[model samples]
Target chain A: MAYTIELFMVSVGVGLISGALINISIGYKFHNKGGLIGGLIVGLLMAIL
Target chain B: MIEVFGLNLLGLIGLILFFGVLIASLRGWIPQDILPVQSALMLTAFILIILAFILGKPIGLKDIQMNIYLHPITALIAGFLVAGALEAAGAFKAAINILEKLSKTTLGLPGTVVILVNIPTIFAMPCGRILAAALIPAAILFGYILAREHKQPALASIVVFGFIVNAAASCGPSPLGGIGMVGEGMAGGLGVAGVQLGSFVNAQQIAIMMITAVTMLSMSLVFKITPDELLIASEEKAEEKREKKEGVSREGYISFFFFFIGIAIVFITQPPIPIQTILIFFVVVIMLVAKISVKDLIGGVILHPIMAMISGFIIAGALVAIGSFDVMIQILNVLAQTPLGYIGVAVLIANIPTILPMPCGRIIAMALMPGILLFGLRMTEIGLPEIATPILLTAFIVNAAASCGPSPLGGIGGIGEGNLGTAIGSSGRPQQVGIMIGTGIAAVIISFFGFI
Candidate 1:
C-alpha cells in the first residue's frame, strides 16, 4: 500500500510536470492556451488510470 | 568487395550522412533556422532506419530497440522540473540580493563579481540553463555597473559573457542530469572495476572555474564588445526597474533554504528514495511555502536543451543500429597507427567536440560517447597508461559540456548575446579558446589526482 501510494504520488507529479511542459512548449509556441487544459486533463487521466 | 576501406558500404553511408548533415547544418553551410539541426538529425535517424530496413540488417533492430538511452532523459526532466519550482519561488532573486550585499563587504565589487560569476559552477545544477536563465539579469546589472564605473563599455560584455560561459560549462560537474554523468555512467557500465559514478565531478568543477576565469580574461584582452553601443534604452530601463523592485521576500529565502538543503541531504545520505521522488517532495514543500503556482513553473521550463538531448539519443540509436560505431572505431584505430600515434590521436578525439561544436553539447556527447569509449580503451590497449582512460574521458566530457558556449546555432552564448544586443557569434572565439584551455586543465587534473 505504501509503495502504491508513493508510485501514485510520483506519477501525479510527473503528470503535472509533463502537462505544463507540453502546454508551454507546444501551446505557447502556437498561441493556444487551450493546450494547457487539454494537457492537464490527459495528464490527470493517465495518472489516475 | 562489399567493404570500402574496412567499413561496409552501409556503415560508411550512415557515418557520412550522420556527421555530414549535423556539421553542415550546425556550421551554417545549410541554413539552420529553415531546417533546424534537431529536425535534420531526426530526419537523418529516420533515413538510417529506412536504409537499415532496405539492407536487411537485423543488428540494426537490436541497437535501435535497446540503445536509445533514457536514464539521462528521465533525470533531466526531473531536474528541470526542480529548477522550475526553484525559479518560481524566486530563490535566484534572493541569491542575487545576497551577492549584492556581499559586494559591500571587505570583498568589495571585484571579489563579489568573481563569486557571482562563478555561482553556477559553485552550486552545479542539472541543466546550466537553470542558473543561466535565473541569474543572467544579475550578470547584466553588475556588468553595466562595472562598465559605467570604469568608463569601459566592454566590461559589460566581459562580465555577462564570462558568466554565460561559466553557466554553460557548469553542467559538466552537476550531479543531477549533468553531461559528465553520461561519461561516468558509461564507465560504470563498462565494468571498469572501482570506478565511482561521480569521481570526475570534482575535477570537472575545478577545471570549469579556470575556464570561466580564462573566458573573462580572453574577452577583456582580445574581444572588444561595445554593449553600450548596442543597448536598447527601453530594455535597459525595464531591466533597471525590475532589478530595483525585486526585494528578497520571505518566501524567496525559505525556498532557497529548502532547495540547497534538499540537494545537500541527497548528496550526503545517498538515500534509498528515488531522486525524483525526493525532488518532488521538496517541490511540493517549496510550492506551499513560496506560494508559487504550476503556471509559474511552466513558464520556467525551456524545451530547447531537453529536445536537443532527445534528438541526439535518436541519432545515436540509428547509428548504433547501422553498425556505424564499429566503422568509426576502426577509422580512429587506423589513425592511431600513424605518426600521430595513440596519444596524439586520443588527444585529437578528446577535443573533437570543441573542434566541431554543436548547439547543445549533449548532442555530440550522446551520439559519440560509445565511439569515444571504445577509442579510449583502445589507446590503453596500445600501451597508453591505464590512468589515461579516466583522464581522456574527463577531458572529452568537459570539452563537450563547454563546446555549446561557442556554438553559433542557438547555443547558451546566444542568451548572453541577445541580452547584450550583440551579434550572435561575437563571443564565439573567446569562449572557444577558454574551453580548449579548460579541457587541457581537466586532463591534467585527472592525471595527477584521479582515483576512478
Candidate 2:
C-alpha cells in the first residue's frame, strides 16, 4: 500500500513537471520568457518539496 | 443585516463575482477564443489577488504558486502532446484505416462502430478533440458508405453520434493518458485516504466501459438499428477504390509500433518510470521517426488547451486563496448530510459540464474534482460508508468529463458539427441531449451500484 501511494505521488509529480515543461515551451514560443522562468522556478520548488 | 443566504457581505460579494465569471464564461459572453480560458483564469486570479489585498489577507505569490501545482496540469499537457504526436504521425489514421477495413469484413458496420467508438479507451490520451479529428472523419465516411448502400442517411448519422458519445465517455477511463490521468491526478491530490491512483484509474475505466456499452446499446435500440443494416457491405469495386485511395504509409506503421509499445509499458510496469516520462520518450521517438522538427512538436503541444488549463489552475488557486472553495465545501457538507441532498449533489456534479457548457469543461471538472472529493472525504469523516465516497466521486468525475460530448460548446460537439456541416444548435443538439441524458443515466446507475 505504501508503495502504491508512492507510485501515485510519483505519477502526479511527473504530470506536474510535464505540465510545467509544456508551459515553459509555449512561453518560449510566444516570447514570454518571464513566464517560463517563473514556471521553472515553481517547478524546481515543487520538486524539492 | 447585509448577509444573504447565510453569507456575510464579503462572502456574498465573492460568491456573486465567482458565479458571474462562471456564467459569463459558460454563456459564451466572454469570447474565449480571443481572451481564452487561460486569460479569463488569469484575470480571475488578479481579481482574487485584489480581493485578498482588500480583505487584509493578501495572498502571496508563493501561496498561489503552491496551489498551481496541486492539479495535474502536467499530466494533461503530456497527454495532449502524446495524442498530438500520435495524430501527427498518422497513428490514429492508421487505426481508422484498419478499423475501416474490418468494417468491410464479416464483422460489419456495427462491429466497426463499436471498435471506432472504443478506440480512444485504448489510446486514452487527454485531448478528445484530436481523437475526434481522426475518428469523426472515418465515422462520417463510414456513415456515407452505409447511406450509399442502404439509402438511409439517418442511420449513418445515428451511428456517427453513437460513436461520438462512446469516444467522449472513453476519456474518463483512458488509463494510458487523456482525462483519466487528470482525474487520477486530481483524486490523488485530494488525499482520499487509502485510494490508489492507478487502481482508481482502472476502476473508472471499468465503470466508464459499462456506462458506454449500456448507452450505445440503448442508442442502437432507439434508432432501430439492427446488426444486419450495419453489416451490409459496400460494393466490392467501391471497397477496392477506397483501399487504393487510402493506403497506410510506412511511417504510420512505425507510429503504431511506438504507440503500442508505450501502451505495453504502461500496462506491464504501471508507473515503473512515470507515465509522463514514457509518453515523452515515445513522443520524442515519434518525432524523430516521422521527421517532425522540434518546432513542429512544440506547435503540436501548443495547439492543446494548455492556456485554458493553466488559467483553470490559476483560477482554482485564486478561488482557494479567496476561500471560495471553503464556502463551497460548507454548502456541499450541508447537502451531503441528507440522502436527498446527497443525491442532488451527485446529480448536479455529474451534469456540470452540460450545465456549464465550455470547451474547457474537462479542465473545469479537473479543477472542481478536488473540492468534490474533499466533500466526499468530509462525508467519510462524518461516518459515511468508506466505499460510498470513491464510488460517488468516480461517478461524478466520469459524468462531468463524459457529458462534454453533448454540449455545442464542447470540444467533441464542435468536431461533430464541423463534420456534419450543420450548426450544433440545430443538428447536433438532439444528439448532444441524447448523449447527456444517456451518460446521466449511466452516472445514476454507477452511483447506485457503487460498482467501483
Candidate 3:
C-alpha cells in the first residue's frame, strides 16, 4: 500500500502538480494545455507501471 | 525546564527566535548586512546557552562541537578547491568553446541553447557561484546572439535567467559539499545498507533538466523579461569582459579532461575512502597540470556559506541539547494524524526550504536536517515504506539546494540580475515556479526509479 501510494506520488501526483503550476504561472491562458494533458497521460502510464 | 507544546520553554523560544531572525533577514524586515543570518544564528545559539545556564540546563560546548558534521563540510571545501583550480586553469573555457562550436551543429541554436543553459547542472558544482561565474559571460553572449537571431529581446532573458536558475539549483546534485550530501549523510545514518553515497545524483540531474526548461518557458511566457528593458550601462562592460578572454590554453583542456575523469572514477568505484581525500588528490593533479598555486586555491573558498553552515550546526546542536528535535518530531507526528495525514505533511515538510528560502540553502539544510531525519524515522515507524525515506530526503534536499535562486538576499540569482541590470527580485517568481515543479519531479523520479 505504501509503495503504491509512493508510486502514484512520483507519477500522476507530480504530473498533476506540475501541470497546475505551469498553468498558474502562465495565468491560465491555456496555451500549454497540450503539455498538461500529455503530462497527465504519461504520468498515469508511469504510475501504472 | 518549563514545557510548552512538547518543547521546553527555552527551546521553544530558541527555535522561534532562530527561524524568526533568519526569515526576517531574508525578507529584508531587518538590515541583513548588519545582522546576517550567520551572525544571527550564532547569537541565537549563544542566547540559548545563556538561558540554558540560567535555567540549569546548560548545553555543553563539546555537545555542540560533536553535532557539527565535518565530513560534508570538508568535502564541500575540497570540492571548491578543485573547482577553483579548474577555473584558474581555464578548464571551463575549453568547455565553453565546445558548446560554442556545438551551437552550429545539427542540434542548432535551440538544442545547443538547452544544453548551454543546463551546463551548471551537467557539471554539478559544489557551489553554483563557481559555474555561474565561469559561464555567465557565455550565457550573456549566447543570450545576445539568441535575442538578435530570434528578434525576440525576451529570448536573452530566457537564456540568461534559465542558465542562472539551472546553475543555482545544480548544487543540489553536486557530489561535493552540496546540500544533497547533508541529506545523504542523514539518510545513511538510518543504517540502511546498499545506500550509495551519491544515490540522489541522477534524480536531481533529471529534475534540473526539466527545471531549466520550465524556467526558460516561465521567463518567456510569465515574466516576459526583456534584455532591452533590463539593459544597464554595465552591459557594455559585460561585453568587454567576454571580448577580453583569449583562446583556451592547452592546460585548460588537460585539467578539464582530468576533472570529469576524477568525478567519473569516484562515482563508478564508490571507494570506501572519504570523498575529501579523493577531491584533494584531484586538486593536486589539477594544480600541477594547470600550474595553479595553493594561494589560488585559497581564493576559491567562499566563507559566507561555510560560516552559515557552522552557525546552523551550532544552533542545531543547541536545539538538540534543549530537546527541540523531540518537540519538532512530536509536532510532525501530530500533524501526520490530522486530515492532511502523513503523506501530505511529508510533502509540505519537504518543500519548506523553498517556501522559506534563504540566501544560502546550506543554512536551512544543516539546521533542519536532523529534524527532517527524525521525522522520516517517525514516518517509517508509522509504516511508511523504507523507500520513502530517500524520496523525502531527495525532494527536500533538491528544494533547499534550489531555494537560493529566488532569494532576495545575496543568492546566486543576484549575480545574474546584476549582470542583466534587472531588479533584485525580478527573476524570483519564475525561478521559484520552476524550482517548485522541479522538486516535485525530483521526488517522483527518486520514487519511481527507486534511486534509494
Candidate 4:
C-alpha cells in the first residue's frame, strides 16, 4: 500500500513537471490539440468497453 | 460534507467557471493565466461562504474552521508530496531512458518502443487523459531528443505512443486503471450487476489500444516526417547548459530512481486513492529536494485540471438543468427490454457521454453494468419499475465513453485539448480532429461486442 502511494505521487509529480515544460515549450495550442485527440480516443474506448 | 446530486456543489460551481475559461482561452478569446480550477473553485467556495456569512446563508466566518478546508488541502498536500517525492526518486527518468534505449536497438529500435512503453498504463490507470498528462512531456522530450538526432520517425513514434496508448486506455478497464475505479463503485455501492472488471477481460479494451497503436505507428512510417532534425546545432547547446550542472544537486536522478521505485511499488501494492497519488507525491518531494518552491510545486498541479473541474461543473449543471442525463437515461430504459437490443443499447450507451460533460473521464466507466443490463433487458422486455437499475447502467457506459471522446461540449476532448496537442488552430487540426473522431467512434462500436 505504501509503495503504491509512492508511485502514484511520483507519477503525478513527474506529470506536473512535464506539464510545465510543455506549457513553456510548445505553447497551449498544441497541448490542447493533443489533449483533444487523446480525449476522443479515450472516450470512445471507454464507451464501448 | 455538503453534497449536490452525488457531487459537491461547491466544487461543481468552481469547476464550471474553470471549464468556461478553458473553452474561452482555447478559442483564443481569453488570456492564458486565468485562475486554475483548483484555486478558482476553492476561492469561489471561500468567497461564497464569506458572502453567505454577510447575508447569513448558513456558513459564517466561524462556521468555516480550518477543518472545513482540510479535505481539499490535505488532498493537495498529499498529492504534491506523493508526486514530488517519487519523481525525486528517479523512476521516471530510468523508465524514459529504458524506453529510448529499446528504441535505439537494431532489432527493437523504433518499431516496438511505443508498445513496450504503453501496455502497463492502459490497464493500470483510471483516466487516459491523466495518463496523457503524465506521458506527453516524456514523449515530447523523446521527440525533442530524436529531433536533435534527425530521427523524425522515432520522434513521431514516441509522440504517437503518448497520445494513443497512454491516453486511450484510460477509458476502459479489465483489471487496471480508472475504469476499474468506477467499476468497483458501481458493483459495490450501487449493488447493481454487470460485468465484473476482473472477471471480464474482453477484447474491447485490447482491440482499441492495438488499433490505435497500429494506426499511429503506420502514420509515422507513411509520412516519413521527423519534425525533420534540430534547428539548433547540438554542440553549441551542450556548452550552454553544461556549466549549470555544478550548482544543483542533481534532482533529476533522484526523480528518476525514486519515481520508478514508486511506480513499481504501486504496481505491486495497488493501494487506495489509486497509485497516481503516490506518483504525484514523489514528484513533490523531488521538487522540494531539488529546491523548487511551494508556488512552483503548486503550479505543477496543472492549470487544465482546474479547468477540467470547472468544465465538469458546467456539464453537470447543464445536464441536470436541461434534463439531458435524465432524457438519455429514459431512452435507454425504453430500449432495455427487447430480445437482441444489446447492439443498439451498447451503441447508444457508449455515445451519450460523448455528448454530455465531465471533469474526470473515468466517470464514464460506471456505465458497464447498466448498459449491459439495458441490452439484456431490452431484448427480454423487462419493463418493471424495478428495472431502472439496468436502465441507469446503460446510460453510464455511454456517458463514460463519450465523456472521454472528441465532444465539443467538454468531454475527454476538452481534457485532451486542455492538456495535450490537438489540431485546434492549425491546418493540422482538421486531420488531428478527424483521426480522433474516426478512431474514437470505431473503438466505441467495437467495444460494444467486446472486440479487443
Which has the greatest TM-score? 3
Clash number for candidate 2: 3
Q: Rank the candidates by lDDT, best first.
A: 3, 1, 2, 4
**Ten residues in a row with the worst lDDT in model 4 chain B?**
B425-434
Candidate 1: residue pairs that collide: none
lDDT of each: 0.73, 0.56, 0.75, 0.39
lDDT of 1 by residue, A1-49 (tens): 0123433443344333333332232112222333333333322322222
| Cα-lDDT of candidate 3 | 0.75
Q: Which residue pairs does candidate 3 place in steric collision?
A: A10-B444, B76-B177
Model 4 chain A weakest 10-residue run by lDDT? A21-30
Error of 4 at B432 (Å): 7.8
* Local accuracy of candidate 2 as per-residue lDDT tens digits, B265-314: 56655665766677788888898888766665555564445665566666
Docking verdict class for candidate 1: incorrect
Q: In candidate 2, list every pair of residues with a backbone clash.
A: A19-B74, B125-B178, B126-B178
Model 2 docking category: incorrect
**DockQ-derived CAPRI band for the predicted complex in model 4:** incorrect
Best by DockQ: 3
Off by over 4 Å in 2: A1-49, B1-12, B32-34, B175-177, B189-191, B210-246, B302-304, B336-339, B426-452
Best by lDDT: 3
TM-score of each: 0.86, 0.76, 0.87, 0.50
